[model samples]
Target: MTGERYPTTAEVVTGARELTLRYPDLCHLGVVGRSRAGRPLLMLTVGNGSRNVLVVAGPHANEAAVGGATVLRLAALIAATRQRGEDDGSAWHFLLCIDPDGAVLNEPWLHGPYTLRSHYEHFFRPCAAEQPEWLPHSGEAEAAALPETRALVGVLDWLRPVLQCSLHGIDVGGSFVQLTSEVPGVPERISKSAAELDIPLERGSSDAFQWPSPGPGVYVMPPPDDEVAVGDGAHSTWAHARRYGVTAIVEVPMWACDRAADTSPHPDPEQALRIAGAALRRDLPLVAEVLRAIAPQLGGGDCALLRTVRELVALGPRLTADWDPAVRALDAAPLPPMTNARVTSIEVYAQRVPLRAAAMLRRIADVPLVARLVDEWCAAYERAYSPRWIPVADQVEQQARSVIAVYEEMHV
Candidate 1:
C-alpha cells in the first residue's frame, strides 16, 4: 500500500506540469509564486471557460499528501470532462501545494500507515496568523506578510472565482463541510457522498453549534463579520472568497472513530467544558517544565522544526488564558446546549495533553531521559484515549469522493 500511496509535494508539482503538457489547450500550468523555501508554487488551470472556480490544497503542510492527491485527481477529472467537450462554462484553477516548505517538513509521513502517533511525530501546524493560507491581508495591502500566503491572495485577486473550495483535513474527527452560503443541493450531495463512503458525519461541536447545519455533515461557515472570525478580517480563506461568491471548506477526517458522532445530550455541559479547560490550563506548567528541561539537549539543528514546536508550546498559554471569565459567562447563560460528541471531543482533547507535549518532546529529545519521558507519555495517552485508527486509504477515498460530489452539485 505504501508503494502505491499518495504523491509528495515534488510529485504534485511534476504531475501538474505533465498534465498541462498532455492537455495543452485544456490545461495551462502557471506559477503563482515561490514558497518560503524557494519551491515553485504552481497552478494548473483545467478548463477554458468564463465561470472560474479556484481549488486549493496543501495549504497546511501536514495535509499536503492527501490533499495533493485529491487536487490532482480532481484536475484529471475536470480535464477529461473538458477533453470530451463536456465543459459548460466551468473553469477550474488549481493552486497546488501553497506551503511547500511546510510540506517538505511533513514529507516523511506522506506514505500510508498514517496513524495518529505517526502523524503527531511529524506534525507541524503553524499558528492561525502565521500560516500561508491563514495570513492577514485585506484588499492588496502592499504585499502579504508571508510570500506563500501572498501568492494565494494574488491568485484570488486575479481569478475572482465564483466558486472556491479549500481542501483540508483533520488528524482526527469525522467528516464535515463548512460552506460560506447554503447553496441548494450541495449539502445533500455531501451527505450522500459521505454516506456512500461510510465516513461518519461530525455531529455537533461547540464551534459549529453556533451555525445551523443545512444537512448532515455540513455547517454554515462563519462569515468574516462574525465575532468568532480570527485576526479581524483577513485571516480566513472564506473571508477573501466571500466577496466573489460561495466558498466551501471540505474537511474529511484522517481517521474514524464512532464516538466522534455521538450526539446525546450530556449533563451539565457548561461546567464540563470549564473543567476541561481548567485541566488544560493545569497541564501548561508541566509542558513548560518538560520543554525547559529538554531545551539544552535539543541543540541548534532543525531550527524550523524547533521553532514550530516552540510556537506550539507558546500557544498553550495564550489559548488557556482568559477562559475563566468566559467560562463564568457561559455558566450564567441559562445552561448552554451540549452534546455527547462535544463532551467526548473535549475529553479527547484533555487526554491529548501528554501526547501533544510528547510530540514536541520527541522532536528535540535525543536524550535517554527525554526519550523515556516521551514513551511514558505516549503510553499514558494510549491508555487514556484508546485510539482506534482507520486506514489512511479509506479516509483518502472518502474525502476525494465527498468533495467531488459537492463540486458536481455546485456545477449542477
Candidate 2:
C-alpha cells in the first residue's frame, strides 16, 4: 500500500498497468477520457464477474491521499475477488485521478512529513464549476462539463453497475460517509475500521450540514445543488449513476479529531453555526481587499493557485447563505449532538476557509503580505489544534474496510 508516501497520478496509472500485466485475465487497463490540461484518464477493470462496481477517486485535487487509497483498493479488490468462488459476480473498476491537472498542483505535499501546514501551503482545489462530477449542460450559455465528466458518463452508461462508490477525503477531521441510499448495518460495520485506527466519526463536520444522516458518520446522499452551479439531479453524476446503481461515498480524513465521537447535545447550536458562518463570510471580502491592493502586481502564476484565489475573493454573498439559514434551521431541525464535534467544527470551519484562501497565495508567498498571511493562518491553526498526522496506510485501510463493508452488506 502507499503507507505514508502518497502516489502521484502517474504512479497510480502506472501501478494499475503493472497489475494488469500481473493478472492479464482479470485486469484490463485503458484510457477512458482526457482532462482539459490533456492528461489521459485511465480506468482499471479487475475481476471477471458479470456485475460491475465502479469506483472513482481524485475528483478533487486536494485529496491526494484518497487517490493513493484508490490504487490500494484496486489491488485489494482484485486479490479479494480472485479468491472468491466463481459464482460470485462482483466485478470492480477503478477510475484513477479524475482531476489530473489539479493532482499535479498537489504533488508538493503528496510525499510528506504530513503536517497540516505543508498540506494547505501546497494545496490546490479547482472551484466546484470545474469539478468532473458535474455533467455538462446542453445550452451554450451553461458551462460545459470537464472531459473527465464525459468519460465517467460513458463508463456509467456502459457499466450501469449495481453500485458506484466515489472515494473522497479531507485533510483534517474524522471519517464521514455518504450513500445515495442506505444499506442496512453498513454504518455499524464501517465505523469499526476507522475507529480502530483512532479516527472517530465526524458527526458535526461542516460540509453537508443540509443532508440527513442515518448515524454519526454516514449521511444519506443528496443530489447536486444547482444553486452552486452544480447541475440538478437530472444532470449530476449522482443522479446519472442512481438511474442504474446505488452510489456510496466514503470520506476518511488524514488527520483525526478526538472530539468527533462525542454526540452530546450542543448547548448552543445556533451560536456555533453563526460563528462558523460569520468567519467564512468575513474571509471572502477580506481576501478580495488584499488582492485588490496587490492587483497591479498580480500577474500570471500557477493556474490552479490563481483560479482558487480569484474564486474565493470574488465569491458572492451566497458563500455563507447556508450558514445563517443553517443557524435558523437549527431550531427546527434540533442540532444532533455534535456538541464536541460541532463545536470543534466551528473552529475547523473558521480556520479551513481562510487557510484555503491563504493557501492559494502560496504561489506568491515571496511577497511579504502573502507570506505574513500564510504564516499567521498557519500559526493560528497550529496553536488551536495539534498536528496529528494519520498514516496513509491507516487512511487507505479504513477506506477499503468501509467500502468492503458496504459492498458485502449490499451484495447480500
Candidate 1: lDDT over CA atoms? 0.69
Model 2, 184-214: lDDT tens per residue? 8787887777668878888876665556678
Reference-based lDDT, residue 219, model 1 = 75
Q: Please list the C-alpha lDDT of all candidates, in the order they appear.
A: 0.69, 0.73
In model 2, the runs with Cα more than 4 Å from the true position are: 83-87, 137-143, 222-235, 299-302, 325-338
Over all chains combined, what TM-score does candidate 2 have? 0.89
**Which pairs clash in model 1?**
none
- Error at 59, model 2, angstroms: 0.6
The digit string of per-residue lDDT tens for model 1 on 1-412 reads 2424768888888888888888999998888898777888889899888878898888777777777887778888789888988978878998888887777777776664556556676666654545776655457464646888778878888899887787787655677777777766766776676677667777764345556677767777655566443223236666777888877777776666566677788876667677777766666566567778766666755565556556656766555332233444443323235677767666566556545555655665655654565566556555654555645566666666766666667664
Task: Summing lDDT over every window of 10 consecutive residues in candidate 2, give the lowest-scoring window.
Answer: 225-234
Q: Residue 337, candidate 1: how far off, in angstroms?
A: 1.7
